[model samples]
Target: MSSKINAALGREIRDSLREMRIQLSTLNHRVGSRLGLKDADLDCLDLINRAGPISPGALARRAGLHPATVTGILDRLERGGWVARERDPADRRAVVVRPVQERAADVLHLYAGMNRGIARICADYDEAELRVVADFLRRTAEAGRQATEEL
Candidate 1:
């Protein structure tokens, strides 16, 4: 009986996660449109911003995109003034991509509403409960990364 209850709870959690993913994807799409970026372009930009300065090859690997595709996205982003390509200090011959801080600020501004909403929701949870929620989200994200690698 306990095993059955656990399985049911697991399924419920998975379903909820799927719904959240869909909503987030939709939000990203809207944000990308506002920024005059394609979904792929915005996704690559987000990765670059989070990873800090990264080589094009490394960005391609992290984004799971072909090198040529990454090159095109970088070209578009560069032209849009969203990112800058500069020489990697460690390897003078290599190039690294970095987000234009001013542009990143614009992106963050668009997300302000969502961030506030999440903060309000988090306020309802105590530290212990929030810690459990954070742990679950972190593990779930890791599982997703593993699954993507497997694919």
Candidate 2:
């Protein structure tokens, strides 16, 4: 591509990414409000749910949260019935967090509209296009992670 075209595309991509970030942040806040939880609490719940019974220390590392902060987040989640803490069988002294599946349906329902929108948008893409989009998203997410680490 010509330099002019490349620059224009870069500007457009950056603009879109900024807009997406703002929208996602708003959506997350709305979901958190619906569940009566803070964003950090919801983030911890999501991390625990995806990781499947992870140790608190591990969650803190993954989430870039202080262990003390994680403790408070877990306390709130536990109280809200969004997560449960259990003794790790392999290491009796260690505790692992698990998602409270029964409560997950309500949270999932809150995301249904967005999920449907994403599905509709994805339906317009063929396999090749989806692969490209997936690759772009994965790389973009990694870049975001790296940027956060710098801060």
Per-residue lDDT tens digits for candidate 2, residues 13-131, read 99999999999889999999988999998888889989969999999998999999999999999988888899999999999999999998988999999999999999999999999
Q: lDDT for each of the candidates?
A: 0.95, 0.93
Candidate 1 deviant stretches above 4 angstroms: none
Tell me the tens digit of each residue's lDDT in model 1 across 1-151. 6999999999999999999999999999999999999999999999999997999999999999999999999999999999999999999999999999988888999899999999999999999999999999999999998999999
lDDT (Cα, 0-100) at 41 in candidate 2 = 87
Q: Give the best candidate by lDDT.
A: 1
- Model 2 segments more than 4 A misplaced: none
Error of 1 at 9 (Å): 1.1
| Per-model TM-score versus the true fold | 0.97, 0.96
Instruction: Report the error of model 1 at residue 116, Å.
Output: 0.9
RMSD of 2: 1.0
